[model samples]
Target: MTAVTTDPRTGMTILDEDTCWSLLSSARLARVAIAIAGDIEVFPVNIVVDDRTVVFRTGEGTKLAAAVIAPRVAVEADGADPATGRAWSVVVKGRAERLDRFADIYRAEDLTLPDWTGHPKQWFVRVYGDQIAGRSFETAPT
Candidate 1:
């Protein structure tokens, strides 16, 4: 864990980039958001952090189609301790590109991501971490 700076106004703590990346790397589940038909949609996926990018697998569907249309997307993961109200969240914004090439897919196979849906998730998407940010805080006892 890394040091945090508290925001007096909101009583929240700001997490640094290194901390954010570490959090993301340790997380297994994340929410991926993309714009489709002018409306933004979010989907929960089993993700793995490869270097600085978020990688996941999906079958041919809305998410796969949306990525083809608009590569820019946001991936977020958050967790908290309910008893103490200590929480943290990380957001990654980047272009989601499909790995259809044999070499690309082969390289991604090394990551060994499991598909929870138990479907044939042949398509792999990589969201390059262009902009990453996160926050963590300890709230007053409720």
Candidate 2:
């Protein structure tokens, strides 16, 4: 396991870009937060990451409806290392758009959504991250 050494000037633990991308790619699930009817709703989704976009399947419910009209959304994923007392988290702010039939063809080759018990409409949402930020936590030498 690699350790995080803090920068003396900024006092923030530095995580390399590759390390951050690795963490993002390794995450299988993410929490997608959307605004609906003046209420903030968060849904746990099984997502597949494609470069800077996140794709997932959902039913024609609140999440789907919101994404169609309001594509602006937030998605987050994180993990922590208990032994090292270190943790990392990344948040993606992006817009969600419904996938068209043409785009579906490409996604089919690269991603698959397992069948589950739910409304089987199989709505697909693609989130394009406009801004991505991440942070790593480390305990100062005591």
Candidate 3:
């Protein structure tokens, strides 16, 4: 078992820099939501997190088409703390872009995802977060 320490400054349950890095490294799946034509669209995606960048695969139809044109999007992930009856969540707000050859090579070293379903027309999309915010809540002990 591993223990996580909380920061004092933000009662919001601080995830230390190292802990944040570890969580980002270990989490494989995340929900990505984007505002499309005044509607919210969300999809469960297998993701590869590289520092502040998130990458995932999508087919050519809807998700990809939206990403190609969308100006902003949000990505989120979270975990629960049983002892404290609390949970923590993190959100990233940023722009979406199709990786170019240079970025593909740079990100390739850390690329990790479950084996892709056989989909030939699929493409990879990366979201580079410009802003990040996190929060946590805990119930008073009984």
RMSD of 2: 4.1
| Positional deviation of residue 121's Cα in model 3 after best superposition, in angstroms | 7.0
lDDT (Cα, tens digit) per residue for candidate 3, span 1-142: 1225445664456554455545655667778898888898887777788756888877657788788778588888776668768766677789988765876856643576662455543467888888766656574575
lDDT (CA) per prediction: 0.88, 0.74, 0.69
Off by over 4 Å in 1: 82-84, 139-142
Worst 10 residues of 1 by lDDT: 1-10
- Per-residue lDDT tens digits for candidate 2, residues 1-142, read 2335666675456555556556777787788898866888888877777776888778758889888877889888888777776777777888998887876746644675542445454677889888776777765544
| TM-score for candidate 3, residues paired by index | 0.72
| Candidate 3 displacement at residue 73 in angstroms | 0.7
The number of the candidate with the highest lDDT is 1
Candidate order by lDDT, decreasing, is: 1, 2, 3
lDDT-wise, the better of 2 and 3 is 2
Quote each prediction's TM-score.
0.89, 0.75, 0.72
